[model samples]
Target: MDVPLPLVPAKILTAPTTITQFPDYPKTLILEQCKTIKDLNQIHAHLIKTRLIHNPRVAENLLESAAILIPNLPMDYPISIFEKLEEPNSACYNLMIRAFTLKQSPNEAILLFNEMCGRSVRPDEFTFPCILKACSRLHALMEGEQIHALIMKYGLGSKGFGSNGFVLNALIGMYASCGEVEVARHLFDGMSERSVGTWNSIFSGYIRSGCWEEVVGFFREMLEMEVGFDEVTLVCVLTACGRLNEIELGEWIHEYVVAKGLKGNPTLVTSLVGMYAKCGRVDTARRLFDEMPRRDVVAWTTMISGYSQANRHREALELFHEMQKTNIVPNEVTMVSILSSCAVLGALETGKWVHSYVMKKRMKLTVTLGTSLMDLYLKCGSVGNAIEVFRKMPSKNVFSWTVLIQGLANNGQGKRAIQFFNSMVEKKITPNNVTFTGVLCACSHAGLVDEGRGFFVSMTREFGIEPEIEQYGCMVDILGRAGLIEEAYQFINNMPIQPNAVIWRTLLASCRVHKKVEIAEESLKNVVKLEPMHSGDYILLSDIYASVGRLEDALRLRNQMKERVIKETPGCSVIEMNGIIHEFFSEDNIHPDLVEVYNATENMMEKIKLAGYVPNTTGARLDAEEDDKESSMSHHSEKLAIAFGLIRTSPGTTIRITKNLRVCMDCHNATKIISNVFNREIVVRDRNRFHHFKDGSCSCNDYW
Candidate 1:
């Protein structure tokens, strides 16, 4: 059975009045009674109409009546009533200040406090707490201290009610928020009285300051002292748990939350799901989400982002569609997660839908959304749309700048990519290692080895960011592309961090490019061991075997790959067809355009041959028969696609092709020949590198 949420009871304190004699009731006694707002307002209206509140005692009654009736209302109405008096007493002014402070306009409270001076009415104990409240909310430590000095001057410091729970709590909050934690603690410990709010403020301060151990220890101390947990405490602790990657503590908190029936609170549930997800337990996050009684937009967003961070991109997209099944609207956070999913999966259609949705719904998508949109288009192989999104953004942060730089770099616009990076530095928006990674990648693709080295050194010296393993991979790729094999290898060895699989693969690919078969074999072992789950290492090793004239060993490696227990990543390619795009890969040939593509390819092969394109079989086995080597190079999928693009498009039309693997040297040569013969430009973005073929030359310069 579903239950209802907690309800807050309305409360108002009425004015002191004479007890009336009714059926032997006490005469002239103090009247203390609760009255509704209408009852109180009627009395106030009568007093204002009659001008009877000119009496100090009558004015005090009206002030208390308004405080009781109007606390729920905005302070503006109450302040107007208080301001109307030719002059109100100390109590009247204090209530007005307190009301304004609680209404979130504390500056007005302070300004009013200044106006109270030189008035005949003296500020009593109530005025100090009220003014201190304004100071606390404003985070005006200097003003709070001044108020503190006044409290001592007025001799209200030691009075228990003057230095009451609310006033002391505000002082603690003010000190903690201003980073004076020790002072805050000293005051807290010395206080004879503390409320639940007092304890919560201190615990929250510890969490915000990243004092994780203190957070844990204080939570325990509170429990030991018999202070119970609240939603705010759980939220703060769970946030700290996520940052600390404390999955065990996170689970304990989740269990506690579930037992206490706190799971219905969306904020707590969101925090728990996010905590589990951030701790690398997306499955646990989903489990928690499933058990929850209700879900808000934040809960759904947390689950979506959890899948994203875990790289379960398909699941993320699935969640996005599922969220639409419910009435809850997707916010900017929801769009951010979906955009990340699109970026990972290269889902251009889904990304386009989100872009249209943003426009139609008039959702105020932020700069992060714009940046992710640019990235999604680029990853989906739509550089035109990526550039369009980039131009539309009003402002660009480092991520925004990096996306465009990376997009241009990925599209083989290296000179423009470098120029963009230079522009980023000039604008004083500091670039992170990820930005430099893109620039370094561009240099590697463009064979800007000198520039790569210069940037590599400057990234450390100028920015103080120590290079990570990926940066080392870029340096090796830069030198490797230039055929400076030994220098690339030496640079990897000199790296402070251990080289990962990508670093070794860069060296091996360079060896394949330069036909240095012996070195390729040595590098292949490291790459294979580094990522044993992936079969590209084995495939690459076999290619080196084929290049070195060891056809038997190449076959042996292929057989070993088949026999290995681990599954290989299937080969894949996306093709644009009709008004939509289709993906076909790995022994699958069901594309509608397949027959047309193949026939066109057959015709263009002849034209390419007539143009004097000699397939470079140096990447094949050295001892293999010439016929076998030539046959393998002839029907490569990338070459087939390039030929199809050439014959299917117009004479001068630019051919844009995307492949799932690095376009081989033989295919690169064939593409260059076709580009020159057909008098067209061909842009092929393949796995591992990009190639811009034009006038019998490639942007990779035949190095990749």
Candidate 2:
């Protein structure tokens, strides 16, 4: 076949001496200059015509460059050339083995290695590393052990045959990558002289297996022995530090990197950012990220994720917008972080836009991304959207199922959540502690006291899952919400673990609801000792005292709160419209449309009052007059948000609101009336659970 030659300089093609006149190794120098497969084909044909294809250096170089070094070439080209050789040498075998490994064909590499062994070709030091790397990729521990035996049989171990550390380094790496970290450690300790690569292999092993402590200890030993380290070493240690939250050691490493003048390296700098970010020093992480000369997707994603982890969700969303301005495309990880931020802020429109973007970009609905989207919808009071995402997911893991179950529980679909949990169990998915928390929460919100007790016992007896404090809290909530105040208090006292402030607060809140002032006082005593300055605890107790006609006690408690400088957490609510989040604070006048919103709120109060809505002012100040208390109840954050929603959205549109605190009974009752009077569905996600109000009813049925 006539091979078409590529466009090349005439002077080079017609040089005074053709490549044939050069020595075999020099001929390879010419082969290295071939830019494309066509260029290589022209030279390859010329070499075959000139009877120079037999030269090992020329053949191996052509195969290595074309098959491995060159970009975008197919594997068949080199494999065909390799087969045409009359007697392929070990060098050609090594080239193909490496090509297979690097090109994501580790299986082929292993098969070729076995063929080489079957052909009785002697493996060299270079050959072992290539094959060992292939073994590492495949996690072929059995094959790797066979290779190790070959190493010993051929006297290629560190103790025998002209020992170089390359073979042993590869061996250690293979063992580590196969999850035999201890064996890797054993090999590492037996080394008479260790290279930087040797240390890195063991560190990688420890990291891959999540043995973070071993990494830290080995790094300490490396420092003590005065072993010189490089960027690889620092990156490894920094990763371990990030996972372990070793901020002090991570800081020292940062200083060392600065002293070594390695601060210019982007990877090392990104590692520093991750280390600081994981340790809750997001500000420092941002500073370093800002100073980076170049920020890739990974660096940007790390910083955004750091913000989400620290609960600085708004900043994460802001940073994501900034990232979009640049050329770097936000990947799935970036989307997950941004969605998490949107979930916390209740930015439903923004979350929907992100979901649309994912669809437009044709990104796969991976479990992580899908779960995040479901969470965003669930938190934003979009239960239908969340359920849709959950159903469309191609695969479901324990976490994905748990997120769905928890989201359903939060959305007041507790019965459905429990059904989903049963389905998950029938499918043989083991539930973790978080799953049970969601399950118990479903029972608690649905007022399934009997079912809650059954599962709480079944968690340990059937699944061997220990009941964490969260599950215990759910039980208390379950009993308390059902008006079993005595049983709830007994359950708290008989708990295996010591009760925390949250437990006492749960009981206290229940007491206020059930009008048990005596138990409320006792619960307050325990809560005060555990969390003295907690505003909610004090507020709950005060409300209970006022409900039982102890106005003096309520007034005295309010005075104590003021004297102690403890203020109630102001209620905040968020609603999304036109892709932007609008926040309403109690009695807030800072919004751009404050006058309009307040007018709408007053109008809403009038309409609901005509529908027989009355403000329940049990928690109001005992010193305030009835009119002042009623007026105060009218401006609650959620009520204002609902009024704003009624104004901004067209009639009949569902109004969704997320509140920072539990919705007060007055707002809840008024909202139910407002929903019926206005003929609209209002979904309010309080701090605890969802309340869907429509036609003079709530999803919780006034139980919560």
Q: Which candidate is the best by TM-score?
A: 2
Colliding pairs, model 1: 546-620, 546-621, 547-620, 548-622, 549-621, 549-622, 549-623
| Over 4 Å off, model 2 | 1-67, 70-164, 170-180
Compute the lDDT for candidate 1. 0.75
For each candidate, the alpha-carbon lDDT, in order, equals 0.75, 0.89
Q: For model 2, how does the per-residue alpha-carbon lDDT over 1-704 read when each residue is reduced to its tens digit?
A: 99998878656645333344445454455456767766677777777887777787778777887788778898999998899887778989999999999999999999999889898888877888899899999889999999988888877444662255888888888898898998888888887889898899888767777788989999999899999878998899999999999999999999998998998999999999989999999999999999999999999999999999998887887898899899998899999999999999888888998999999999999999999999999988788899899999998899999998998888888999999999999999999999999999899888898999999999999999999898899999999999999999999999999999999899889998999988999999998999899898888888888888988899899999999999889999998888777899998989999999999999999988888987898766678899988888898999999999999999999999989999888888899999999999999988888898988899988878
- Location of the lowest summed lDDT over 10 successive residues in candidate 2: 13-22
Candidate 2, position 689, lDDT: 86
For residues 1-704, could you state the per-residue lDDT of candidate 1 as single tens digits?
Answer: 88998886687667756323321221111123425455456555655666665766666655665554443755555666787788787888887787677777889888888788756566776887678767766778888777666655665537644466766666676666666678778888987777788887776656645677767777778878998768888888887788788888888988898798777788998899999999998898899889877898999999999999888877888888889999999988889888887766556668889999998998765688899899887776577888888888888899899888888787777788899899889999999999999999888777788999999999989998888888888999889889999888788778888888889988987886676776787787777778776777776767777776777888887777778865555545544333233454533466566777667666776788888977788665444689887765665666555655555556786656656777666777888888888788876667865577889898666656
In candidate 2, position 118 carries an lDDT of 90
